[model samples]
Target: MKNIKIILGLVFLTISSIGFISCEGDDSGPATVDGPPVINRVTLAINDSTTTVGLRENMYRIYGENLATTKEIYFNDTKSYFNPTLVTNTTILVSIPKETPYFDASDELKVVTSEGVAVIDFPIEQPAPEIDSFSPVAAGAGEIVTIVGSIFEGLESVRFGETEAVIVSSTSTEIQVEVPEGIVQSYIFVETLGGVTQSEQAFGFKFVIYDDALKEGWWVGGWDGSEDFENTEQVKRGDFSIKRIYNGGYSGFQIGNGGAPLPISDYSAVKVSIYGEQNVGNLRFSINALNEQELGVILQVEEGQWNDFEISLDDPALIGENELEVFSQIVIQELSGNSNVIIYIDDLGLI
Candidate 1:
């Protein structure tokens, strides 16, 4: 046979060339190798500004292949659907889903991977500035108020009730604070970042009351230190007068040109007018400020019969003296013995 039929055709071509090299070494084994997964880098984190409105927690990272099988993530156009968890298929841990109720300031974030999607462009700031209404509703300690409505731009503080107000100027709407001196009817809060806004009503400032008829040569005397007293000659019939008789026991009334020195500051308070008879015993009318070494209670003439007395000099060394030498005494140390009471002293001004 022709050499055994050419040795069976060379052994059937060496068994079909060893089954074509074992199907090319099992198709170059390594599990069907396809390639395409070296993404190297991608990261993002959020919160530069998003002043409240709803869910907004972002964090993402992807460094290559199977990125833990990333699912989806997109911000701005909103859409984050993730469930990835594969720290080393080539790292991937994304979670950004909770921000959708309006309040986007130019947002941009994306990361969807089956092999595609990856973007980042964050910038969503703005929302931190609020304080509305405040304009002379009543401010008096030192006054200087003006804080009117809506976002004032980063303005950090402006408080008055607890103290700390002296902004002076700012604008986005308005701000001019200064009312800080133990504010009494308080309520004025204005901090920024869009949180803390108070003052819809409640503001007060203004207090200073010191009075006692104008002084400068104030005259009216008679108690031996005579300027020749005669308010109709200390009446004793029809007007009932005694001129000056403070019966605490020591007696009263003595201001004389004979002593000549009475100007006692332009006045802070002191006004007298009295007429009493019923055996008066509790009569007091004092105003002695000869430079005040401490002794100024001013006026108090009470025994019931005719009354009109106003005295007040809040005590500050008896206020602005040019010559200051006031004196209008009366108060008989609660009459101890010798029943004799009758009072009458009129006008005597300096307020």
Candidate 2:
């Protein structure tokens, strides 16, 4: 009886050991996850590190549970493409496509998975408007001014410096607004749902010498037969630009005022737009006494493209020996011994 009882005890101990081992090793893998994915957070990589911003065409990491079976992703209802290789059970790597619309978007990032769909708040923005060029850069108050650029959709405001003007019309690539007083000589600004854009070029000039026509109190020397005060062929700013054909090297023109001297303190630079037909020698731009075309600052000229020269008032060559408040003369002469060239000048002014 004692031997039989010992054997029974040993068998019972062996059975308990096997049960313990089976309980500890029962995990096959992370058990087949069931139910919808739970989005914990979303993150982005910037500078090869981690940051967070929903920029178009930027890669992002979606952190959640049971996300390995992601099937589709939508940025504000615009379906986006993703790579399956970058997906995992707890995270997904995806990129927001550029074609996704942001203007008037729902701002919801929706992810569709095999288990279920998960929607999260993802803020996006439209691209800022780009100002390529604006027509009638110089216009009077109440005049219709047109702005040309891209991504002008959902415009918010159009300011000609400080005062917001009335938008006459708006399009994705263009906008027309009425010019306001006191802003005709300041930089134009545009705003949209995304952000604001300031024009690289000012709207209108402060004091004009020649636009469609020469302003009052301004005159041209019209030196020799080389100056065509009105040339319609390659007008840069307005209906006309002073076109000059250099007879040879060192030939140029001059502009002066009889009674209207510009206030030197009110301006910071002398802006002149020039379009060159060929590589001409440097232009010596000078401000001196009436008819003085001898002393000035030298500026390089480019061929086949328009160059805008804003000779600042700080340049010693620009203000040498000349009265500041009585800035009336402007002379442009080519450097010594330069070849013959043709050039068009427009928007000669003080700003």
Please tell me which predicted candidate would have the highest TM-score against the true structure: 2
lDDT of 2: 0.76
- lDDT digits (tens) for residues 1-351 of candidate 2: 999999999999999999878865643223345778878778774434544347788888887777777899888888888888777777778888888777778888888888899998786768788899998766556779899998898899999878999999999999999987544267889999778999998777767778867677776774432777788978775589888777667766776887755678877667788888764768888776422534578888887887777777667776665567667778887775556678888878775
The per-prediction CA RMSD against the true structure, in angstroms, equals 21.1, 16.5
Residue 163 lDDT (model 1): 82
Clashes found in each candidate (C-alpha, N, C closer than 3 A): 19, 0
Clashing pairs in 2: none
Top model number, lDDT? 2
Instruction: Score every model by TM-score.
Output: 0.24, 0.48
Candidate 1, after superposition: displacement of residue 296 in Å? 11
Candidate 1 minimal-lDDT segment of 10 residues? 205-214
